[model samples]
Target chain A: MSILVSNLSKLYGDAKAVNNISFEVHSGEILGFLGPNGAGKTTTMRIITCYLSPNAGSVKVEGRDIQTESFEVRKLVGYLPEQNPLYLDMNVLEYLEYAAQLQGVTKLMIPRRMKEMVDVCGLGEMKHKDIGQLSKGYRQRVGLAAAMIHDPRVLILDEPTSGLDPNQIVEIRSLIRNLGKQKTVVLSTHILPEVQATCNRVIIISRGKIVADGPIEDLQRNLHGGEKIILEVEVPGGQSFEMVSVQVRSIPAIETISLVEERDGVKKLSVETSNATDIRKDLFQLCVQKGWGLLELHREKTSLEEIFRQLTAH
Target chain B: MKFANIKYIFQKELRSFFNSPVAYIVIVVFLVILGWFFTSNLFIANISSMRTVFEMTPFLLLFFAPAVTMRLISEEKKSGTLELLITKPVREYEIITGKFLAAWALYFLTLMPTLVYYISISVIGKLDLGPVIGGYLGLMFVGAVFLAVSVFGSSITENQVVAFIVSFLIVFGLFMLDKVLFYLPSTLASTLEYISVDYHFSNIARGVIDSRDMIYYASSVGFSLFLGTVVLQKRRWS
Candidate 1:
């Protein structure tokens, strides 16, 4: 495992911020740390990064204990905080160069390493701009570049793309996906579509605890209950409309049938199935025997948003 | 971990002070007011030493040092950059020390230009070099203590304004105790005066380098920095 957290807990006065949370991430895996506001995702990331010590638990990065050997653990991890902490007075190149030096990149390698990061994070156009002058998206890119300057084995980002335009969001998501191909990336965000587009595994956190953890497909399947089938039938006159509805609902796995609309005397029916069963074959057979004109038939898969709401809702 | 890395962070922080208007504004205001006070009270009074400037330094520090340090950790906390710094393989001490040294360097720079007063006194009057050196040393010591207190205040809050107010209150409280001690019983007043930061500063400003005075200033700075470290640790758990 690239990262291991066991029963980690943090308390603020009488309130618990992270309550006995445990999870692990393997090398080269991008794990989406999903949570609503105040769900302890940021707190948990802080603990793993060794910014805050856990009240009772252990975090190990590359077999090194974070509590006992914090400096060593820090050397193996790069963290981008939620608010994009940066010294606005400094220009982009200057800031990244400073980060590189602090990360102990050899003096001789500083130029080469900084250039590589600038290119990788697409910071060429704004390299000389003062951070305060850049737009929100550019500032976020600068923060990401700062994190990757050290080239650590693990990357932990908290709300990496919290406030960006739609175009910037796509750019950052693609950048994170590219980084995940070579490094272990653990990031938390409330944006569900970003997870579906970027992460392979998702961990849903709610109220300081993990409620669900698995592949995206598994989560969707578990929350959706069954497949959804839509059927379009041409029914001349209103005589065949009732019959078609009854016939579609009569199938064993077909749970409900709703008529979407009647356009030019063609009836559209939506069928919900019980499980993973595919009823299209049976419907095709019935249509052939009854000479019912079948215009269109397709299945509608469950989306990640529906699954995410199901997991995170209180 | 490496000396080179510490130096890197230290240099970057020091350079950043000059890269903006904030540092220039602080230095200009500090030198103008301090110079005006020194000339009006010391030079105009025909005093042969820097006693007036040295005497008012702790009070000036009650406000000036906080302005320098209020944003050190507080701004980092506000921007969410403290986490980035902590995860960069740098020890906590290195981070704190680098920032402390940067603030101290700027403080020292603000003090350096005031030496023209020393040069002017030497040229125009019969001066005692011993007390003059002693007064500068005492001022630097008191400034260090104030810097530590201000840094600690910054570590505890994310708002720079709150940090400034908190640090000012602490430093002002320490100075006020010296004057308030006169009203207490003899023994209690003497004991309280001994613990007062200004009392030791006065003794050293008079060209007396007592061992007890040195220990008092060192201990104050050490204790405050230790508390600041504890504050950072507690913030993590909370």
Candidate 2:
């Protein structure tokens, strides 16, 4: 294991920010910390980074304890806070050098690591530009570069992709995926698709408790009731819509089917199944036999919002 | 505890100071105020001592120190950058000490141009080098203590203006306690006198660098820096 958190509890006045939460991150794994607003995602990341001490338990990064061996644990973990704070006066390279030096990087290796981080974060063009002049996306990149300057074994990024446009989000997600190949990464975000795109496993937190934990597939299947797909099929030249709908309803694996739209002899239906089965092959074979063109067959991602609402509705 | 970490923080802080026009504005205003006082003492009073420069600086530091340190940690806290620095391999003491030294260094540099007074005096008249050097040393210690106090002030609050007012009130008390000494009984007078920065400063400014004065300055700076670290650590536990 790379990071172990055990029974960690933090209290803010009378309320608990993190309550007896425990989990572990294996080496070379990307763990998405999924949570709604005020769900203690940032608090957990803070505790793991040694920025805050747990009220009742401990965190161990690598083999170093956060409470006792924080100096060593700090050396092993790199943190990018929720705000992605940076000294806006300094340029990218200057801030990276400062971060590297603060992390106790050797003087000889400072320049080498600085250059490597700039290249890794795609910050070469903004190396000398003042951070305040850069856009939010570039500033976030600088924040990432600063966090990775010391080349630590574990990276704790809190809402790393928030406040980014779609294009920037894709760029940062790919960067995170690349980093996950060699380091243990715990990325926290409320975007469900973000977790699906970059993380291998997810831990959904609500009201300071771990509401769900497992692979993304398991979480969706367990709480969501079923997988869903949008199927758009073209009607045969002579057959009516009734015939196609009847044939589609005959498939036993599909428990529910509803027509979402119909126009110009093309029909869009939502298919929901209770279990993970490759029904696309079955649907395609049916379409081939019926002489219907498969206009579109896209799986719909189960929204995490509904799961959070169901769990936290009380 | 690591000097490397402290150095990094120190350099970053110093860069931030110079990057804005605030540092230049403060330095220029400081020089103009000190220059006006030094020249008035020389031409109007017809005095040739570094006494005026020494006397005016501690009073000037009442506002100057707070202005220098008001944004140090307070801005970091407000912007949430303190978490980024603390989570690095740097210790709490390192962060406090680094900022303390940066503010003090800026103060010392601000005092540099006052060297013109000593130079002008030596060229035109007899100059007593003893009090001049001792006064400079005393002023440095005084600035260090004030800056440390303001750093402590900055750590306690997230608002920069609040930090400034807190330090202003504290150093103001330390500066004013000496003037009211004659109004009190001898025992209490002596106690407040010892606690007052102006009392020890006068002692050293008279060309006497007593170990007691040195001890007072060191302990004051140490105590204030310690309090600043405690404030920062309280945030972690809280």
**Highest TM-score against the true fold, candidate:** 2
DockQ of each: 0.72, 0.85
Residues B102-194, model 1: lDDT tens digits: 888888888899899889988888889899889889988889889988988998899999999999998887778789986899989888887
Determine which window of 10 residues in candidate 1 chain A has minimal summed lDDT: A233-242
Candidate 2 lDDT tens digits, A218-260: 7666786567988998886746656776898777789888889
- Candidate 2 C-alpha lDDT tens digits along B94-126: 899999988888888898988988898899989
For residues A123-167, write the lDDT of model 1, one tens digit per residue.
Answer: 999999999999999999999998888788899999998899999
Q: Give the Cα lDDT of each candidate.
A: 0.86, 0.89
TM-score per candidate, in order? 0.92, 0.93
Interface RMSD score of each model: 1.4, 0.8
The fraction of reference interface contacts (C-alpha pairs within 8 A across chains A and B) present in each candidate is 0.90, 0.92
